[model samples]
Target chain A: MGQPLPAPDATDPRRAPDWVRLLEARATAHGARLAYRFLSSRGEVVDTLSFEALAARARAIASVLTAGGAAPGAPVLVVLPSGLDFIAAFFGCLYAGLIAVPVPPPRPHRPDHRMRKVAEDSGARVALTEARLVEQVQAVLPPGADVWTVDALPDAPEAAPRTPGPGAVAFLQYTSGSTSDPKGVAVTHGQLLANQAMLAEAFATGDPTSDGLTSKFRVVGWLPLHHDMGLIGNVLHPLYQGGECTLMAPETFLMRPLRWLEAIDRYRATTSGAPNFAYELCVERIPEAKRAGLDLSSWKVAFNGAEPVRAATLARFAAAFEPHGLPPRAMTPCYGLAEATLLVCAAEAVEVDPAGRVCCGRPPAGATVVVVDPETRRPRPDGEEGELWVHGPAVASGYHRAPDASAHTFGARLSDPDDARVFLRTGDLGYLDRGRVFVTGRLKDLMILGGQNYYPQDVEALTTQAHPGLTSGGAAAFAVDDPAGERAVVVAELHRRNTEDAAAARDAVISAVLEGLGLSLSEVVLIRQGTLPRTTSGKVRRSACREALLRGDLARLDGMTS
Target chain B: MTTPDGTPPEAHRRSSRASSAELRAIVKSRAQVEKFLRLGLAEALGISPDAVDPTRTFTTFGLDSIKAFALTGDLAEWLDRDLPATLFWDHPNIEALTGYVADVLGLAE
Candidate 1:
């Protein structure tokens, strides 16, 4: 039958070398499986798409776009939230052989930095957005480009999604960038498939019949669909494993930390993950009432990743959730990014102490890490804190159209003789204790004050804990360069409502940060609750906060007598 | 319901809608309508319970682009719709947003 489709080779697997064909095959195999779920604008469950149903819709969308004289590999800007429709449209772009460029969904309250960054970087001609918000995205579209909503597409008959050969461009993921300039990582289909395969093996769930782990796992995550973690880790990984998924907006999780655990309990989700901030947020904010009902026993692989994995934060989260039946071993802190198709290294479910600290663990299946000296760019010995580099099938190809950015980030890195592979410069400075990697801070985020290097997170921890009025886990510390250039700035969000007398709280935080880190802060802005800029996934956007401080957008301390 | 922390003592009894509208009007009075429509509406709308239907909302009233963001700063001006930054997630639909605006302005049926 058509040359017996040749025994699945290492180069060309049976799962269509292309993402479009591969997704279709999965949908055909498991049509009724739930693909996505989200909180509607009404704060109620509105949309849920089964794999089979989603595939049929994607096929129709691909047909409509193809009929519009669109060529393969052309960029399609998507500005939708995490929903079944967003998933369908994303896959539809792939099936139609169009490069899906996922931009930050319109938050409608935040800065346009993310949206502008995506549009400017991709140079996308067509933007697919929600029917109600087409004008919002259109206002920012690059000159001469057409923007259309999902409903604008014709209801055409289904056509087989084009299966681009291996090594072809598939999508562009935009990471942190300023409003004027945005950085996008180009991911090829081969890169995506390779990364997923590594994950499948690492998670021990590829073909449970063969991989050992049960295949009945469900992935539940609250990270934004636009982010690499949510798109790849939570969305694609489950689909590849032939599993189900449940998702919600990041705001929902942040507003009510307990909802995260509830989702896992309701779905009996086996795998779920978030950055270190999420765990800390839950421990610090979740009300006592919500904690009484949560049952985290069903969770087998709870991931804590994206940002640096804090030893203290994980310890506290486990202790807090233990009462709710969350097993100590369920916490799995992994490391990954958009450059690595969302997974580079992930800790396994291992035994943890009462303190809630588990090792960052070993490299996932085929993944490897090399800690290198930042200045020398040479590999360093274990237990030494340096720039963490990752190498594996998971590393992305490079930046789109910006070879300089590509070489600066992925191309020019020290190679290891043992691995003989190009490593992704994680830009994260961390040390390995035994085999577990302990991330300290980002290279750009590390503050150099008084000869000793200090991570802002460390300072923030001390500040929040020391200040009685200031809420723990609600403070952000970043370096701001002013006339008195390159000084630390601590911004604390107070628990008590705004007071004419916050000098005591501010002074306490400042004293703690300065005394703990042995450096003085140039300014300390005590803001109301929920003032810091954050990604959709709830990770503090340090860069944005710095930008706000430099531009004088933050409230001034001029009037504070303290 | 939780309220904005910075409200003055005199504003205690007033519904947040009036202050929100006062803030929106102030933001609208100074910024360009196109800019407000592009960025301000999105930012105000993101976490806000206020939602705006582009088709039926601000465009229906003959408010010019300049009136869109006189109170909010430049970030809000870049948005395509003229809703305040708080309207993104909160009042995302047209009727709810208009009701919010009307309540804030103290406009009655």
Candidate 2:
């Protein structure tokens, strides 16, 4: 049922070059059609917005923003919770030709360092949030930056949407970098549309003419709207296809994953997805008795991405939900990142490699994926593991305000003379088997747990600061497979080999991580002095340390063994 | 605080800031609440109910942030009321959490 997108026409303005124009066209054609439905945690629809109403709200917010001295192309932070207000504010930024920076709202009674880091890095002078959270958002924003409540904006007369050039930065997607330094990927309007179109083709979403089944291409998702997968894949994908999207807060799903399936069944969602942990959570938490009276037969595409796709997770999920009318073929394991503006490759069918890694399928049209040896910068043959280098329209322009990092990551050149194209060095190690991509491991030491990225250096820094026994710069943080999912393991060398000190240090490390980063360590191994693996330059080799920890080669302190 | 159909009780349906007296009247007995907490913690940590010692902190059983949040969510669902997101952090051990819950529901005798 999937088909390739039509060629771009530079002359035809009605074809919707950017998201602003796309929404304008949809407003004109499907003015009364339901665009979004925001649901409460109790499975009740709290708010609904039609295309026309959404356009009107966006225009009003845009007018207010412009009147408040927001210059076009300036970054505006959209720091609201998961609701229709967040969606309207995001579009309002585009309607005003401003770059939208979507960040998670600050938690209650917590010091929001991440929000402050994002606000500082994006250089956003204005933030848009709900009435209830205006004060909280304002507290974390830079001193001069102002916060406005989106819900209280007065209605304004409709104005024509601004059509910025396709190359103009539409939004800044801040990847989960370190707490001190967050990286915001500058995604242009052209790149966003290209990735959405590719998703439409790959998932076969919004195919109204395919059959009666394609008539209602709805999507139900509970992923956090601040993240790339939730914003691009769940929220925007439905609008791109002129279909309705039903959204709930991420906490709603995590609280009871059964609500996700119940909503999908109730809404007859044709396309929906989350990270692999969500599916595993459902299979683990949802009892068999709760599966009664649910009908997922109408569900078509269940895309899994944003983290490693485990063969065991997919198989277990399918086995658990198959009785509820979920087709085994609907389990789509895809791969993507924030730098790529969302999707890179997606498999149509569930396939596994000999190494138990799920096949991420081939790159979509208009995207070229090549596996290359990172050290030699030469292309690797099929079935050989190498870094995945991508060159495509979907790739973002670069990191905002980071020239060196942008050049190092986005301006990669292969050593092969035949291929002169510049590629985005995806720091992800994988191998291509006859054109299909299979991710083996991460070339970068980034740990992804619960669809959130955690840099090891950040974890190690927090671990070392927790106690005096933990030697400074002697901690190595890494992820290991657990029954629940990937869990963080902190291996630190103690300053002294005292058993009492080791126990105290372990407890201190766990509490510090939880209090500082709001994360829990699965295990904390305190090794003797100089037992950790380090390079000649004294840089900790996380992979080597992880191997040593797993193999029990490290001389762990007494009572610190797993 | 669940009805026969497992829906939240009337007191919990009002708001998150319900009066303690109203909650006390509608909530289950303290022993039943403790049993539920132990069972829920065991289910979340994937261990037997007996293994869930009331004296030990949740961190001792390797309950990470996500699992702790999920356990809180389940407890909220069972009691049919919204609890603080930092419920686990504020009440580190089962004994402390049970005491907090009892005080909130006015179960102190």
Candidate 3:
């Protein structure tokens, strides 16, 4: 509500550049601004915390973590849901100079594979979780590590040290690892500052403050904080812009899709984001009664990314909520990845062309997105489809402990061989049509049958459309190459009663997938909905599902084979 | 709704009409139903029974149709409940769905 003093110059040694400083800055300026709200089902704020309060708690947490024998730079795996405590733990780690590795919170229905993968990959010396996960984390803790809840940590010290500097490593974000082994992308404070500054510059151009400070913008999000999009896009961006944010647990968003919209209305959130599926969920699930009295005029930036951006999903959401004052341009379908510190190209909140569409507008000032041939490493023509390569300050310092992987994914040249530009090879396959990124699909998820490439999403989409019983957005179509040659198999979850016969369900699923995808599915395993493994962010864990199917350990769909 | 040690008056009356095993099945299915409705039926109804009656109305469990749709669509999948999409309104509650399952396939004890 008031103009704040300017932040000290970049060279000032007192201010550190990591996320720790982000919280500290907020505490210094507008410390009383509401940073979080734990909402009830009715969208009432059940609990609220100010930025200064959160920062102080984080400083306290940093003292406890350091006192608990946590070595600086040691990987501290965080397995917690989105909330005030989650944010505190994340920033506390940054303050203490520890590497934060966020894993999805465990689900009751999922097999132990996710925990196993995280434990193996991170080699975490400590696991910070909630009371609900105490026993589970204890049971799943790797050979050597301590597990503690938020309450278990010691009180904040009255005098905690200042935030870490810009050169400090902030996090080790593990890629989805669908193609190869999961590699941790090391993000530095300087890299984060650069990316967030670019993002703020792009979105905050109309912002009234010439000092690059903002007080009007606010973020409301339900995306999993563990994700790059959630951590940087929704959380850090708001803090960097000197604005506040409201966050809810991912389950809250998934369980009640309309609650997301209600939060925007209640909080008057100016900016928010989610992937394509989230918009699809809102479109399919928001009830007519719940839609009453809803106004989305204040929601300025609604980003769709983390997965391929779908034009139809955006169109449906816009059409359904137009009466509620939901703007078409506010539904921005963007593109980016973990390598780029979460964002690459985002559409400005503006009206789309005549064609019912959502465009991932253009790369921000310090960024460039080029479609390149995966084989030749040459930039393709303007409108051609190829691997999307990104160059920017957001391009993170490569994989932790894996120099070879870092080299392969982060640097490749065009022409002259020796003159190379540091570019992140975003394993995403897409075409540049009119300089806008139209994501086709993931290169790793592509199935090659008879030498023709087929995207799994195409088959999965058709399966959901054909069979009402088949779970939407919960199917996996993957290629299995054996002595019998390569064949595509679609594993779909079916909604049915336990008393229902299995043979009938399997037959129905196979027929539906076959007819929909126009290819005979090598196998159709009718798993119970939610039985399929999923990331903490509610994304269908395709890699885990494929591994389960391959190992004959897909529990609910076991015993019967189609 | 009552404490874990005591049954609610409505639940007590409903349980008298069904056997314990049948009630257990209903309770098991209600877990699925909670996923179906997405709301925590246990918390909403304020009932912590290890089992529930299969023929009672979902309204008795303190849920309305609007919240029921959210649960059925999203929560059901997250909770691993595999009920038909239309079942949210049809079954409505643990007891009603249990009764429906029994009538369809004689699953009642």
Candidate 4:
């Protein structure tokens, strides 16, 4: 039953259309086999669930949900700590034929406004949570939302949920927008399966290969489950192939990133990835002197995505771990967004591009990715840079009920008069070089100075490498429209303890920008560490920083001046 | 959100070390606990210490869950007491947190 049934490519019809069908098959075939294992902050396995056990719990939860009479396609918010209960509740909602909306549990330090906005926007009437969080969930929940802990549900499916059709809504994935605003993308069941197959096909993960389909690969990562990268890449992808994932909380990894590698070493895991900062954090945070006897020989597919995939970060990470048995080609750079269901283009076993940019491989089979000049809306030839346009079955139906916003982003067509096809306009700017997508920078963040466009990454990287006094990962470069014209501003953060070096750091930033861009910076405002604002997912919100600069709202260092 | 003292902005405090005696002094009294939380949160958020209102929740003070977890760990070590990860979740604001810390650590006065 576990034999690789069919095609290893994108059209692998064996990649079941519905997840519910797959789950039932997995339970019957791999009943005793472990489906998931959750690790504690100490890196110990705290909970383990088998496919059979998971199916039972999910069915019970489904019964509770169905007995309660939730609407057919209503979104149910699943907010809880990372563990087996979350897994059960998630599949439970799926089994009940209700759209699952997974959100990070409310943290006291973060604003609830975003969660409240999502609840209202998605009109989620039922929230699946724990006893301790009922009060808090109710605080933001609409008057009708019924908060029930996973344990509070009945222990059996009283009424079996009808099997969802191909077009049935699967879930509403909320985009990690500015903290002040939130957006949800409606993903259909068919699209979700399409992405599952695309990822499996692109990465050769869980597919039948020349040696025959061996379900030996296990996913291990601490990427948060709420993010698309985490939900779709780390969790669901593993489940889709009847394989298991060993997961630890994001805080656990951040608190001690070495534990992420150490977990992979201990578990003999083969697949894992996080954003670029995670790889950099391992190198920066984990001193080689202390990482003794570590072995990463089994690791592969160290994906770098979500944020811009930096070539330098990959090189540094590979070099640092090379002694511990990491393959040079294992670091795969991918590019995608929530609008496209977490996978748009990915490298098919690629290496670093010589030009210092990791080549994000071609789009998965049946998906079309084109580079389009935003101004002319015409397709740019190979090796030319432009906004990336993605058209695929995996593309989201639209933003939840936000027609104008959805139409603006989802209904974009190529500039060619003869061709007619809708494309998901990824606001990222990049070029198609050698049939691969090399993401350059954000379209919103592209800085135009003196009739020439400058991507912020070039200037930001220079400012970072320009001086050792400045903190790594703490530079924001954006163009401001001053009275004269468009002028570039660099807001850099000096090392926290070295307050006296702000002056020297500012000079270094200026010199670096001048050297890199051959243009003098209009202003180099050196601030304290963690000053630059980041989105919830940790990408620098340069536009927000630009607005703050224009208004002079920066929390500048005492001696630092623009 | 300017500092009321009209003083220069303070620098980052995460890297420095404090004496055990100094750490004890921070949790000595309820007011001291409140003051400690206010300044600690202000530093974490990269905002003015005066900008942090003791009555405001940590959400208002700008602590994401990760930093909030770090805060609990730090507080547990500083006060030399067992602290729950959900401490901030239960005590939403600094005032409540301070009161709870004082009561639990026997520093209410």
Candidate 5:
């Protein structure tokens, strides 16, 4: 198809490409075309930016950073709300040849230690944010890192643009890691563009020669700009295709699920996506009256990812919105992680395996997926479950500043004699069946709820700190799938077992988790001391504890409710 | 019925705080606000209204951030007022939230 799309090779001078160059060319080619539209909570267009305006603003912000003595390859933190300023600041960092780090703004009245930890880990000396969040971001950022309000910067049309090499770091994605140790995945320009190309090939959004197809590639979404799915999949993918993207705040969509569908209808968006929970929310919360007005026929790709894809959720969503012009083939279940730069595999339609796991489709062109035995580092045959290992140019080189962790995760060599490629250990367990990927479960002890990653150790530490009677290393936190969604359940061993003390301990654990982690526990089980299962080395076996809890094998403390 | 934590049930707490006639006379708006929050919280938790104790904190019923925000959004829609995003966090219990909401609506007794 039209020269078979060249592989993304940053070293090739003939095709040396980066997002900055791509955007600059697009600005010159069609400066007046719509780039992004920011929508208000009520679905009103509050802000609009064309390619020309976006390029100008990015240059203005870049000049400010460059004039302020920002060196090339330095990491700059972008802590702004979901709006035009966030997008401009991100491009501004790239324009200045600095690595952009996008993170969520701190919540009001809450001490954002996570943001502070990220700043400390990345060693970001300059932070860009909106005017209203200048003070908030300044309070959380490490001392000496200047916080500049992007809106206040003056436009500098003659600013000298800095062009970074393809191998240079483009951005630092800090989606993984715990609060105490935040790891920033260093994604190079080559890897970023390569992943974007893979996505285009998989979604068939390439080929700019087709004017009709290019115009029909409009994307509408409300995912947060900081997350990988939103940044890479929703934001960058549209730019790669030279298509328009309309965005609204995640809170706006969550407040009223109907607004998302209405936006799709209003914009006639060809692509949109959210996690499985969002689809479930639409089915549960949106009344019938709201559905009558939605016309989702324009939505060609409704991707569900960032968490486990439930067949039931997809079926329910399809059945509910079928009458409103939604085609059953529009649902796409995808699998990806920050380390992979965005997407790894995605299916065009919902195809559930006999085990009830939804298919995530085949690996895109130039990418390879192999299941491997986590213990032996040996590759598993097809239809066998094991840790998934990905090999391709789309996989990131490694985590920034952590060579040992990077080598362990990104330097795996397959045992097969014929295949000597380095594979990324995806910590996710799945199997390949008939050229399709069906994810079974996670091998790591991480819990994903509401599209947010929560480490078991973080939750356990918070739970133990909530009450003195609870043992420090005696708590096991894990996720259990329910019809509502994936929910966390904490089983803790308490020293004191009196009725009042047990009740107080349970309440304290719940409150601490909600306040500290912003998560709700489906159940707080107070077990007797020495009842929690542990390994020979005394580490808590979380999966065993989960199974025991599911089987009602854990001995409940006296006076504790089920 | 007294909860396991020895706290009185929702009905008992309501009656002890103010008689129905006195509450109606003092402020009819307070009851309306409380009923709205109670019903919204019940629906969010997938529990019956009778099982919801207003005196108990929102966290006691395991209200996560997403559910809290969703409930607050529904309350904002029902009241037709632009409530703060931290409405639930600032006033964690139903009684405190009702009081704050009533005060914000200028229905203080």
Candidate 6:
């Protein structure tokens, strides 16, 4: 920790002028102060970048990106591991006025075609990535894909940062890998700044300009840099505060959850969190002996988001770490989506709802949240179930290149013309109670399993074609929550009077699903053909299939209990 | 508890929930430890036991932190001894994990 940088003005959104100028100001003010501390897997500090050093590196990369004929509004792909290199490339995109499209490098030795889909969907010609991944990514790229390692880019004259207008597109936050139709949420410069400020306020991180740590603003977490929570919360917000962040690879945290807490103690980090499963991981993984040396007293706001927050998880985590000094209220069960640029609402307190509704706090400054009746298109009174709609500065205007989809999702208006403002339909089923948003379940059939979104149709498509016994369109994949975690339960109907051996077919189906979509189906129920419920349009009724499985109504052909 | 060859005597390895006779009857050699892990992980991950790659990392099977913790508890129970949650991370693959678990229990080298 060198001489701390003078705090930037984080109060005003009008002055945000996008994130570029803020970085420039912070770089000058906090020239020697640490901006990012990247930790190695062996509990070692591999790289630490100062604010000034980070800016210089970013500017150098920006110069290269601009010199290579990338347009101001074009999307530049950020395909690097979670490290300082990715941070520089991202800031370089913002510096060069390019929308940085961050995505996980194709799963090693596997064709995770999502990379190509995102690249083509974003129309990104050039990709800023590590040298090691250049060959791997190049093999998947269409002809003439400009793949340049950020380190290889020669240090050139620092390009004048291209600052875009407030409404100008900053980055395309790809919501999911919907393969055929990927969603790139068009987050503008204004929304980015607004969301950062809003998140800071919600997380109770006192000042916008002061990096959260000095005033207890430090965020220590191992969330993937490509994710919304990682990008907006961990990376960008710290930059906005002119503060430093201690970041580790997601694998480091996954491989050892204790390292995440160790960093919190090591850095005296005040803010750090992950999905609910992470808290559970720490609770279940960290034995009593390993917990002896840990001191989580420095952890002030351990806000859990990105997945369903279980009250039991919060209680277990608090009870387990109370001796080590993790406060009860520190485990805040908040909620947000990429559509809202990250923090839509954060609860005021840790009040567990008996109905299993995790309180996703009141809307942040200038943000309005309402639960609208799905069919009526009318606002429902608080304490009633309905589709949640959010209207705010942080809410992105629309999905990139998908006008109809954008109009339906973003331009949501109640039947009452008096409330004319457009709201982004969250598609989450929840009710606002006493000004706090309580998310109950998803309105749509989107299943979030193991922290990743898996639409039933995509899974159904994979499972249905798994075996000859399975009808081409007679399979349904749904999520079933058990003690272990949310798992995919596949209920497929086999062809009637088929001579195929049920055991072999079942194994083939399971293997096919794993190969086709890389998803491990927890239970595969082989029912008699035509046993699966279907809608009038001949589409498989996933909910009915799930209900039938749960209620034990489906007839099993193999006489094996699934 | 050491046998003549230095490995822990198979009969001495104890499990709390179950009687030693049944548990002892199951695992006699080093290969059994690998088989035990393969079956445990395969069932936990919902794949056929044969499909569970001994060389592939646990995360390759889409094992998240939640499932890892659950699997750890199961592993601890089967071993009849308490184990740290980092066992998965330390061992990574089934083949390596089985060797580490066996070494910890002093079952075989």
Query: Could you tell me which 10 consecutive residues in candidate 5 chain A have the lowest summed lDDT?
Result: A7-16
Candidate 6 lDDT for residue B54: 92
Q: Superposing every Cα of model 2 onto the true structure, what RMSD results? A: 4.5
Candidate with best DockQ: 5
TM-score of chain B of each: 0.27, 0.73, 0.38, 0.73, 0.71, 0.73
Q: What class would a CAPRI assessor give candidate 2's docking?
A: acceptable
List, residue by residue over A1-562, the lDDT tens digit for candidate 4: 0223365454332345577776776787678789899988767898998989988887888888887789778899988877779889888888889999888787654446557777878888998999888888898887876787985664543667457866888888884443324568888888988898788767667646533323577889787677788888888887787777899988777655777998888877778998876887688656675366688887867887877676677778888998887876678888888889988877865556666566888887789999999888999999888999999999999888789989988999877877888999888888887778887666777564432346677778878887787755688998775422356788877777777877667766765565344445767787778778889887888888888777777878864333
lDDT tens digits, residue span B8-106, model 2 = 433233343565555455556676667767876776666788877888877656677678767777778557577876788788888889889888776
Q: What docking class should model 4 receive?
A: incorrect
Give DockQ for candidates 1 onward, in order: 0.04, 0.28, 0.09, 0.06, 0.30, 0.10
Question: In angstroms, how far off is A268's CA in candidate 6?
Answer: 1.0
Which candidate model has the greater TM-score, 2 or 3? 2
Using lDDT as the yardstick, the better of models 2 and 5 is: 2
Retained true contacts (fraction), each candidate? 0.04, 0.35, 0.11, 0.04, 0.57, 0.02
lDDT tens digits by residue: candidate 6, B1-109: 1322234323322333476556544556667777667766776667788898799877656564446655665555455555665677677888888788777666754
Can you write out model 1's per-residue Cα lDDT over A367-399, one digit (the tens) per residue?
Answer: 778788978878889867798888876688888
lDDT, residue A318, model 4:
84
Q: What's model 1's lDDT at B39?
A: 39
Q: Which ten residues in a row are the worst by lDDT in model 6 chain A?
A: A1-10
Q: After superposition, how far is residue B50 of candidate 6 from its true place, in Å?
A: 11
lDDT of 5 by residue, A1-562 (tens): 0134544345322243677787787677668899899998878999998988888888889988887787899999899889988989999999999999998888776788878888878888898988888877777667766677897985444567787867889999888767657788999988999898778767766544565325457899888899998898888888777788999988888776777899999999988999899999899778675687788998878889999999999999999998899977889999998889889989966889887899999888889899999888897889999999999888998988889999999999877778779999999999998777899999888899888888999889999999888879989999998865788999999885443588789889998888777788878888988889999999999999999888878888764333
The TM-score of predicted model 3 comes to 0.69
How far does residue B40 in candidate 5 sit from its true spot (Å)? 1.4
lDDT of 2 at A197: 72
Regions more than 4 Å wrong, model 5 = A1-16, A154-158, A207-209, A497-499, A558-562, B1-28, B47-57, B107-109
Cα lDDT computed for each candidate against the true fold: 0.64, 0.83, 0.66, 0.74, 0.82, 0.77
Model 3 chain A lowest lDDT segment of ten: A1-10
Residue A318 deviation, candidate 4, in Å? Answer: 1.2
